[model samples]
Target: MKELQQLLKKFFGYSEFRPLQAEIIQHILQKKDALVLMPTGGGKSICYQLPAIYLPGITLVISPLIALMKDQVEGLIANGIPAASLNSMMSDSEQQQVKQLCIQGKIKLLYISPERVKAEADWFLPRLDISLIAIDEAHCVSHWGHDFRPEYTQLAILKERFSKVPVVALTATADKVTRTDIIEQLRLDNPQVFISSFDRPNLSLTVRRGLNKKEKIKSIVHFIRQHRDQSGIIYCMKRSDTEMLAEELSLFQIKATAYHAGLSPQKREQAQDDFIHDRVDVVCATVAFGMGIDKSNIRWVIHFNMPGSIENYYQEIGRAGRDGAKSDTLLFYSMSDLIVLRQFAEESGQVEINLEKLNRMQRYCETDICRRRILLSYFGEEVEKDCGNCDVCKNPPLRFDGSILVQKALSAVVRTQQQIGIEMLIHILRGAARAELTEKGYHLIKTYGAGRDLSYVEWKEYIYQMIQLGFLEIDYAHANRLKVTPLGTKVLYGKTTAQLTKYMPPEPEKKKTKASTGKKGFKAQPIRPIESESVDEVLWDALKQLRKQLADRESRPAYHIFTDDSLEDMVAQKPITLGDFNQIRGVGQIKLEKYGRVFVSLIRFVLKLPKLEG
Candidate 1:
């Protein structure tokens, strides 16, 4: 423990370990396997990094991205630790040098992609001495995980080859099923599992549904404008959308850039570098952007289109408040997005699983309960209190007795013998005289046209809600026929009651009032709130400018020198001397020796500090 603390302070420049970093590191040192389930920005890198410092031969980290490897390797090198990466991005000669370093016991940590590891097995077979194997993004090994990769399934080879070596698998996103799949696929030998809380209180979460593209762009522009000069990312669902939206933001006079896999590696690197250097205020990108970004002051994240799964959504939003600073996230959703995702799922081999996960994502957007609660619940975590920061918590939807509506749908399903799709069910309820219904029924069923008061779209929304609320299940193997669950059976037989959020129409309301489903058509409710607390704007701006100047001089990202959180702490504390500055969170001995005096002077100038402060 003492050696770990001394190493942490000397190399990482931190005084203490986050939640379970120390425990995981010690477990690895004792040669025990561990499976770590932490949230993104939960200091996952340190769990393996600290172990590498103490482990004997070498710690080989299997990362998923070249950019992720480069970012981590550069940070380690900057701290005077011996780290190197072997990827396709490096020249043959460069790769040979790193391999030599590994053999010579000079490289304590090595980063390689799964593909590189697979390709270089011949080279590693004869002579590779590894003390620890860390699988970053271990969730990819599972087909059920949000970002499933077939390449990761091959990672079990490491365990098969080195049966005696202890392994540590880590990921930021995974539910119970995903966790189990990861463990089985990676072939961990009864690894110790560490699951942390999924709650991220620093992020204010909100979702806006049923919006057109115009409204979505308008809302996103407004959100970006609110954060003015801070760095933020706008995630779109496609490369084309990223390019178009980036152009749109540029027309609006916001400094923005587009990032996607379609771009050449050079262009993508430039975009990432510019964003990191604060030359770009907004990055309109696809999933390719945030996975590798280490920037710490991203004040906002906006999903221009809905993500395909809850896991993807959470991981993307997790990128926003990494520094534990106040941040905002807005997700725009519509039924069109759902249709698009369904098409994708239909084409996928795992149609059943993909559709189920997509259903959960849709439920989250349409839910009237607290958004955070639904998100946490998806990860198997329960929250009993309103998070107060999300859209639903601030302006909750009105709940009403939905027994009549539910009973009508269930009766229609029963009359149809429980073997019908949503469209057929809706048609039967609305008394639509289609050829199929007419030929089959002879207009004799008593429950026909019981839902005539509801439109096609309204009935569809209600059926989807009932499915999500656990009253009904879809039999995918049986042509997606509707099947009643125990809850649905009770509700249908009058043994139980149901409550739901009253639907809202698209038309404008005459006045602002809570929506009530009292025999009137539902009207849409608009919700938005100004939730950010006021900070020291003058000091914030001055400190940012100074940091940028220092970054420009050092040719590095501003956050690399001193993060925004650290600068904010400096301003708030008004540190005057070396000792006072040393007490700041991100300040370390190396930074204090190289750049601390300059930052201290800047802080003194900004605060008009006295020669000494008691």
Candidate 2:
């Protein structure tokens, strides 16, 4: 433990491990297989890394994202830990150099893609000490997991090849079913599982129904403009949608770029690079973009089109506010998005979704209940009362008696032979004389004139609710027609009664408000530069060396222990004692207790001082 402490101080410039990190490290040191589910920025990497330094063999880290792997490797090198990644970017000689380092036991950790495991096992697994195998983003191994990668399935071979080596699997998101699948498929031998809560209070979630395509585009532009100079992403469903939205945002002179599979690799890389370096304010992209990106300042994630599942929704939104800074997640939903999503779901090749998941998603989309409450409840997390951040909470739309309207819509679908879509049904209800209505048969149906009392918009909203209530199904490719599913048939036959909620718009905000568009918390604190650099260049290089050593030993993110913020503050204040270190803002109690002593000691050594003045 003393050795670990010294190493932590020497490498990461920290005095101790984060919460639960020490326990997790001990398990790996004892050769116990562990499965860790930690939130983003929770120090998951350090769990296996700290042990890797102490153990006799080289530690193998299996990672999925090339960007994440590259970023992590850079941090490790900065901290003086001999770490190298074998990814697509490396040349043959570079790969050979890294392999030689591993073979010579000079590398503490070897990061490789899951796809490399089976193919490279014979080459490296035979010669390396192999103290432990750590699977980063372990959720990808599960079939039910949202970010399922085909390459992840090959990870199971780790247990088969290195049975005695301890295996640690880690991820930021995974529910019960996904958890079970990870354990079974990874072939773990009774792994110790750690599941962390998925609550991010700093992020506010909001879902708004699009008035129309043009209105939806306008809202996206408005939000990007609202958070000017902050980096963000706009997710679209189609490649064409991505191109058009990028074009529109560019027209408004927002530094926007488009990313899709359709783009050339060089263009895609350039766009990603631009977004990361702040050359572009926003990257309007398809679902393929922005996974495993490490840029810490993304302020918002806007979905111009709704994602297919709740899992995808949560993950995309999870990308924002990663710096523990306040962030916003805005989703633009419409009846058309629902129709398209449902049609895709119905046609989806996955057999496990069944009818239950379909109904649940529909209810979530149209529910008059609190949007955040509905979202959290879907994730099996509880949120009491309404979250005032959403459209439904901000502007509570009026609720008229929709029981009559629901009955009329369902009756019309049953009478019209469920193939007719929303527009035809709405026309028939509003008593509009369309040629298709006359061609279909008699415009004299009893249910046709029954809904004549409701306006076209009002009646369409009712149909949307009925669909949400499972009494109607809108098939988009089938001419955007409505089909009465078995459930709808039962409701029409009076075998079951539909309890449909009214569709309401968001409520307006109250009068009292902040005058500035800047974030509420986290005042604009001046960031201090490295003390040694400003004071004496030689001393600054010494401090950097010390930080590299500490980062290597602690195996924690260099940024986490003392963010560039804390480092700057350290140089500015030059605290010479634990108590003095506590004076800095943002140094919370947990951090002060764990790291105060080391930072103070470093300061005293550098300045040739005794105790701190304060």
Candidate 3:
């Protein structure tokens, strides 16, 4: 463990390990199978990368995307680690060079796609001295996961071929079901599981509801103006939406671009490249744009429409604040978006699970409780207190004892034999005289007319709350019927009570003022950059510019040189000597010897400090 810590500082320059990284690394070093579930930016890569450096032979990393592999390899190389990636994009000669390096034991880490492993593992495994196997994005292997890929199923061959080699599987998003599936599919031999806390305190979560298209556009533009000169991503649901939003944002003098699978490969690559290089400040893209993006300086992420599942939403939001700096995430959703997403889920092959996930996501957007609490609970983690960083915590809603209301709804579902969906259930409670109610004999249920005093919209809101609070469950497989969970049964039987939020009508949209559309636009409005109070703004900007210059010279992303967190550390510390600079979070011995002097000199110049003696 002591040697591991030294290697960590020597290579990655971290003084201490994150929560489970050290334990996970130790397990891997013992040549045991492990499954790790850590949030994005929680340093999952180090669990495998650092151990690979210490292990005698090269490590095989099966990744999902070419761009992701390339980004990681570049970052590793920048840290003076010997790493290479083999993908379809590389020439035959390039692939052969990486292979030769592996044979000659020159490469410490080698990345390849699951498809590559499926195609050539038989030929590839026999020639190399393999010490470890790391599967990234391991959630893709599960059919229940948000991003299921058929190619990943072929990875079961690894355990069969390399029975003696230890395997480590890692992902940013996975519920219990997906975690189990990953183990079963990969045939890992009783792998030790490590689940890090899913909390990201540095991110502020907000959801804007009841906004129309024009209103959403205006809100987004206002947000961008406040966060100008920082990198952000606006996720749209469609390719056309991306292009239209990009064009609209550009009209406001924002540096924005569009990215989607519909565009030519070259165009998509160029757009991604420009964003990574800091030549563009925003990218209006679909879900396809961000899966492979490893940019650590993304200051914010905006969702133009609600994502279909909580897993997808969590993963997308995880892309922001990777550097552990304070970042903002805004989600704008409306009923139309939910309707469209529900239709898509209904049409998909996995109708039941997809609808279940979609319903959960809708609950996330509509919940009046702590948003972070809901997210964490969905992943099987329980928290005692509400997170004060979300919109709900900042602006709490009114709550009332609605145990009777919940009993009324649950009784209605029971009277209807749990065979009705939400709409029918609501109608029965409100005593609506529909022919189906009459034919089904639901209008005569004891709970009928019990909730008639509440309006249709009010009843709808309460029932939805009941579903979200786990007082009721939606049986999507059985015609979207409502069933009482064990918790719901407790309320139905009067064993417990329920507290529900008071139904609040949506506020009417305010009339637009001239300033909203003035020629000078939002650009002329002054807004402070979203950053910590202690960080030196001017010095931060200067360091960013310097990092960009260095990245341009090396043709790599600015973060490959130093993450925003590292730069902020430097700014706060105002290091003027080589030793002081080396204390920065990301300044390893290699980086210290490579670019420490220039950075130290710049810091001295910027802070007006004395020059170091020769």
TM-score leader: 3
* Cα RMSD for candidates in order: 8.9, 8.1, 7.3
Worst 10 residues of 2 by lDDT: 520-529
TM per candidate comes to 0.79, 0.74, 0.81
Q: For model 3, how does the per-residue alpha-carbon lDDT over 1-614 read when each residue is reduced to its tens digit? A: 89989889989989899999999999999999999999998999999999999999899999999989988999899888999999999999998989999999999999999999977776876788999999999999999999999999999999999999999999999998999999999999999999999998889999977567887898888888767678999999989999999999989999999999999999999999999988899999999988788999999999999999999999999999998999999999765687779889999999999999998999889878899999999998999999999989987888999999999999988887889987788788888999988998887789888887998768877887887789987764566678999999999889999999887764444554333322221222131222333237556756766777777778888898899999989988999899898889989989999889988877776666877677
Ranking by TM-score: 3, 1, 2
> What is the C-alpha local distance difference test score of each model?
0.82, 0.73, 0.88
Which regions of candidate 2 fall more than 4 Å away from where they truly are?
1-20, 53-57, 343-349, 354-359, 370-400, 404-420, 424-460, 470-480, 483-614
lDDT of candidate 1 over 506-583, digit per residue (tens): 333233222211111112221111222323444555566666666777787777777777877876886778888887
Local accuracy of candidate 2 as per-residue lDDT tens digits, 361-408: 556666676777776676577966677776667667665555556667
lDDT minimum window of 10 residues, candidate 1: 516-525
**lDDT: the better of candidates 1 and 3:** 3
Error of 2 at 30 (Å): 2.2
lDDT of 2: 0.73
